[model samples]
Target: MATLVAIGYPDETTATAASLEARRLAKDLIIQPDAIATIIRDREGKFHVTTTHHPVGAGATWGMFWGFLFGLLFFVPFFGMAVGAGMGALMGKMTKGAINKEFQDQVRDLVKPGTSALFLVIERSTPDKAVEAMSQFGGTVLKSSLSKETEAELQEALHGEKSAAEV
Candidate 1:
């Protein structure tokens, strides 16, 4: 199963740096992500999103996923309660596996004004190396579809604890 991981940074620069590191990791085969994106909310509260060109042939799938997610999280409120409800129902019917209400709420909170986030749909990864390499960027894990045990391992790795193999 693919893991959906969202990490929030204090600003767009940090998030962009982290995304580049993630891409490097993917290139080195330390992690395999189906899709990767960076979302930045400007001071004016507008969202700017950029996605990588990896995972060829699945562009349309990821594009729709990101569009719906961003629209639900950022655009719905401006559209008012009625449209929000309609979009909520549509989202529930259209999405599956991990993209539920809680995740959506967490994402909404993560990318506040002047903040940024890195979103990854990962197929697989070397948790230790990936975490170690990324810890320097100092991001908060906004949400993830990983299992409880796996999430714990990731947290430990982020905290510089023993790696998965060591544990």
Candidate 2:
């Protein structure tokens, strides 16, 4: 079983710091995390998301491959390569290149404006110690459970959104 833990903070700075702290702790073997993501709704009403697991150069790689194929199709290898590389780079930037967009959107909708939330998918944790380490940030605990589905249900309940059954 895994636990989905979400913590709400007053601002992005705290949330970001808390996430960094969590990563540092994870490296120390204090907490084992399967995944972690942060969502911040800025003062401008725009949302920003950060995750640790995004490929740094996936765009170029995919672009190169596609470019080669297209070049072969059009009989213009160099031209195809250039176009593919450009298009691939653009696509990568547009996509932020990786991570689950659906999950990101779901989290974006869950938090209020001018606030940030830290979402951690934890495999194992020393509950008391982990809580103590994160206590200084002082966030509203949104959800915690050994089941992702149950956690999702709690989130829906908190937001007064429809449950899966009703949907």
Candidate 3:
């Protein structure tokens, strides 16, 4: 199973600091993450995304997943209500019981213009150490777990028949 953890910070600096801390922890083996990324929404509402290169070689797969997820959470709203609603229904169905409406809503609410967010796909972790180290940054954290099967389903939903490697 993999856990998706998103932390929203008031500014890009804090979010970047938190992302660095997460990378440090991963390097120390305090947490094993499949991938990590940061999303910053500038004052003009433009989004800048940065993704790390995973040592485990899952970078491309998770990178694509993050892009699609961010597109739904941030970009869809700009397409007008009809399109947003249709996409919302699709997201709800695709996530189903895993990353449900509430989780999606919380994520949407957390990330606003002039703010930033750190996203991590954790495979294993020493929760206490990881949380303690990151808590000092003081961000709003939202998390959800995906079973292996559900992850495959999500990948399929996002990319049709393409496998993760092909992504």
Candidate 4:
């Protein structure tokens, strides 16, 4: 699952240093960096944070496209390319692009003033060390499950909006 560890600081330099330290500790404890946060400096010199996710391969998108193509081919009279594209897209999605994209989105949404958040993808059993290591930077904890829950929330939100419109 994805856990967002947020660190807030009064100044940009201190926050940046703390973020680096947190990163180092996370690395030392073998945390897989799913995403990264950035330090923002406002005109008042107060440090703020916002995170953006590094890009991963666009395999999942490719897969979705291929799925549509293959479904079309299978249903259509004679389109062999559809099936091949769909299969290729599925393979690409499974090879890290999908997970990485998910990670990036999670990291990007939470960055704001006075907070630098690191999004870490961890196994259920291995989160303790990462949590401990990252805490040294002194930030609030904003942990969210990185599984179907996030996707479920998205679905729920969409459905809610649609339902509201219906009313």
Which sequence of candidate numbers ranks them by lDDT, best first? Answer: 3, 1, 2, 4
Please give, for residues 82-153, the per-residue lDDT of candidate 3 as tens digits: 223323444565545656568779988988989999887665664345666889998888887776666555
Per-model TM values vs. the true structure? 0.66, 0.52, 0.71, 0.41
Candidate 4 stretches greater than 4 Å from native: 41-55, 59-125, 149-167
For residues 17-95, what per-residue lDDT tens digits would candidate 4 score against the true structure? 6556545654654553324444444545343433323322322222233233223312212223233343354334433
Which residue segments of model 3 deviate by more than 4 Å? 54-60, 76-97, 126-129, 152-167
Name the top TM-score candidate.
3
For model 3 the TM-score comes to 0.71
For residue 40, give model 1's deviation from the true position in Å.
Answer: 0.4
Error of 2 at 126 (Å): 4.2
Candidate 4 minimal-lDDT segment of 10 residues: 156-165
Candidate 4 lDDT score relative to the true structure: 0.40
For every candidate, C-alpha RMSD to the true structure in Å: 10.0, 14.7, 6.7, 14.9
Candidate 4 matches the true fold with a TM-score of 0.41
lDDT of each: 0.62, 0.53, 0.67, 0.40
lDDT of 4 at 19: 52
User: In model 1, what is the error at residue 90, expressed in angstroms?
Assistant: 11
